[model samples]
Target: MQTNNTPQNIAIIGAGASALFVSIILAKKGFHVTLFEKNPKAGKKLLATGNGKCNITNKNLSLNYFFSSNPSFIKYSIENFGYKEFLTLCEEIGLNLVTNENGKTYPASLQASSVVDVLYNEALFLGAKFSFDSKVENIDFKEKAHIISGDKTYKFDKVILATGSIAMEKLGGCSSGYELAEKFGHNIIKPSPSLVQLTSNDKEIHTLSGVKSEANVTLLVDNKPQKTLFGDLLFTNYGVSGNTILDLSREANMAILNFQKVDIVVDIFPTLDKNKLLALLEKKKKILSGKDKNSLLLSLINGKLIPFIYKKAKIDSKKYFIDNLDKKDLQALTYTLKSIKIPIDGSKGFDSAEVVAGGVNVDEVDNKTMESKKQKGLYFCGEVLDVDGACGGYNLHWAWASAFSLASNMK
Candidate 1:
């Protein structure tokens, strides 16, 4: 894998998965590698992934699943060090990965700490130097070094910037990567929070707080279906938020920012056809003609959404049975269950996104080695780049692949 057949002294600018992984691979080859992080420990964000399970990679891997300014650039890294290589690296580092029901790989111990521990320990074992509480302030391209904590400076022949984007402010993420990119003459895409929870200012969200349902959510960009996600969706006082909403958050936010009305289409019953749902409802209405709609509806749904559904359907809580049902009325109920619309007020901000979109434009960096075209002996990787993938281990996969690219190209 080391085509260069030699090691290079490398200074990794961040202690995140991207920098740690590249240091691990390069140091294992007897390269001089030093990883710098402002945090007290490495992999702070790593432990928070997958709600602590740390979804390492997904089974469904394809290039179409990612978004980038230069779409073709990610093809090289992903093709070179795809999901298989990530698993292999875990095992090589003495961490056994176990696959979940959804094909998401996790540490066998089910502890995210185990994965972070392995990466941290492996890097150390490979002779990688880690300097915690080392914040890199400005970069000096002319001197080939980074200014740390506003004053301290770390010089190197080759530098890898992987501090990540401005998402997750609570987790200590910022635009240091962007600042470094600008210092090196690289163009940065306007950063927007991605993979974060959406919060609406609408009062209807209050009615459905804590209500979750199996639904098909479609993102309507200018009332046109841009993408659709099928999964479990949960609603809160903010808005509809879940893996489903997060999947389409970028587009939804972009649309909302453009002053276009953004709406979420949730089909609570995607499997049941209109006629089937209508027939079942009709039969149920006949069976419980005397029962009030409030109680009967509770049994129909998951109980939490009965009132919300009634309000959405404009159905009277006490109305039990309509003497005669017209096709249009039946259609209205069917449509209500099949296509529920919710407005997107805004996202919870960058402090909560799993990954941020819009980074250093990918076209400025060669995916083959993650080297920046704008600067010599400088490489970029991880969330610092524009390429971002859908949820389910895709972002982690990018980190692994980009790191592998950098390590393999050492000379």
Candidate 2:
């Protein structure tokens, strides 16, 4: 608490997750907090999170799920304000949180608007002021921070940049945060799309559009295996989507930005090895010898994928009968099933990305305080920093943890 008779004024530049969290905390600390949001309503991005269910945080809070230029910079904040602390904060704000079996947490009501309404109301109840539709154009740092928004200039004892990243521009994402940080002599790692769909140039793969399956996806960059994951995979006309693709998209997009050859090897039958799959195919062929060769794989895979598989395996469905399938032909089919490589052209970019992979470099920011080392009284939290997390509520957790760290330590 301040010994000064006058309450210190603090301006937060965004009304998203971190901004709201910090506003509530600062207001509780007896500081006059004001949130400047360009959107007419608060939590525009927050409301869209987790498909409107709002994954608040994850039970499995670990550094392994997050990415950054300096990965360890997030360790302090996350450790200090982990899941239990977040739950306590939520409870104090009268927000009930529930966790799924996979450890993804959401509001007990499971309505994203409920979470936003509770947080916004709590901040308002704490006497925090909001400047909706007020986009901060610039901040002049001196002994006091002067926030310029259109024709008005507001002075503050301190300013926090919670403006988020340039991902999902349609959902209120912008580059102003990076621009502000750059003006203050902060280094920014080039931003790239993460948790986004990966596009492929393979026309045949595009023909498999609307095909959904569970598969093992391996991301190969420059002909070397980078990462592998298994989950639901969806084939789209543009490219591939699903939890697996989104998970691998970070590394894939990073490689693509660097002009590296990227490909994803999708194993349609993840449960079966090549030899087992071959044996299964051979067994099917022998049992259904009288069936049309084109219909042989109907039970094994989606019917829409039959033509693609046949084309890739170099087996002519019109020429070869089920009984006439040679061992080599069966082996080729099995190989194609196990290793269907799709050449990645690019990603859907920031327009459709869930979160961006880069922002103001974390090395210049204090991990414990969320304060900029380059400029005192200027702080950062949430996705505005280079730190980002994997899908499944990790990103939102970072927002809460980083906000708590900033609010707890801000003087």
Candidate 3:
């Protein structure tokens, strides 16, 4: 695998977001690039993203938005092929975009299939060929050629290991990406499930199953608050879910593994502060004196959560007004509603996770080129690497940013 000057028939393992980028950019450079996908289709996982709407990239590209083993590794690629550049590329491929209020970019059509189709079209137009049902068994580098996918060996002057990670097993993800990296003598930084819903050990959450509310979740690691998030929280038989809970799930996973107390503080009535909430409840009691608990509570919170909230607050359903409530009762109800706590015991794992965290350590790869420090012709990109970003379009941004360098660096 010498860095010899030769026209590489670059072989990209996996037909995911990064693989498509590799194919398009390398093929455009007039290099022969073959994409191998184990699934019956390319972008199977991509098509499943954003609830099939496909959040392509975040409109903003800032360093604080992502996490990685090598914290600085993403700076170069992100700066070069940033969010704006990615949108421009999408536009070039006939996929115009719309940025949401929070800066998450989606296709104008709002269908993930539209984005996948355009990416597929771009790769095909660039002369890259895809081989489906082509599962890779092993990869070895010899004189600028990669022998991969078992006996069906591939010869490439440069090889991009954009095989992705083990997240969606039913969709063919099983650490093939990590296996490919290890075969090339690279170190993987322990893979685990992330961006998934957490199951709580507390029995209370189960009783309130099917109840969803706009709340905030704060993650505790080693009995310390690690991160906080606010959004829609869904209660389930096993545990808690939804946008807010998912953001803080990784911390819950880590803390739960260590047998630490992992809890989510849900601010059910985020719009009303503690004092204001109490005042509002007192005022409403006088206005709706004869109404039942469900009726009065429904006007304030979702009717679905009334029973559970009443149970947690130790409030009698027979009584409707705060006029009969003592100070202790008022404070308890406010605390339970404004800061309901759920214990984290387990997670939905890869199946429900949007993306997997903790992959090939960034220390072992070149940031600018994504070339493995241990292997001459090998490269890593996408979720298979150690980079994990926050919700929104940050994950897709990482994939595109990492692969953009790989595609450009290929000779």
lDDT of 3 by residue, 122-233 (tens): 8998788898888877777667565567467767677777778788787666787787777766788766677898887788778778887777677766567787777888
Report how far residue 270 has shifted in candidate 3, in Å: 1.1
Q: Which ten residues in a row have the lowest lDDT in candidate 1?
A: 317-326
Model 3 off-target regions past 4 Å?
Answer: 1-6, 289-296, 315-323
| Candidate 2 error regions (>4 Å) | none
Tell me, by lDDT, which candidate is best: 2
Per-residue error for 50 in candidate 1, Å, reads: 1.1
**TM-scores vs. true structure, each candidate:** 0.94, 0.98, 0.93
Model 2 whole-model lDDT (C-alpha atoms): 0.92
Q: Model-by-model lDDT, in order?
A: 0.80, 0.92, 0.79
Instruction: Write candidate 1's Cα lDDT for 51-79 as tens digits.
Output: 89888887667897788878898888888
Task: Show model 1 residue runs off by greater than 4 Å.
Answer: 1-8, 143-150, 316-328
* Sequence-dependent TM-score of model 3: 0.93
Q: Which candidate would rank higher by lDDT, 1 or 2?
A: 2
Best by TM-score: 2
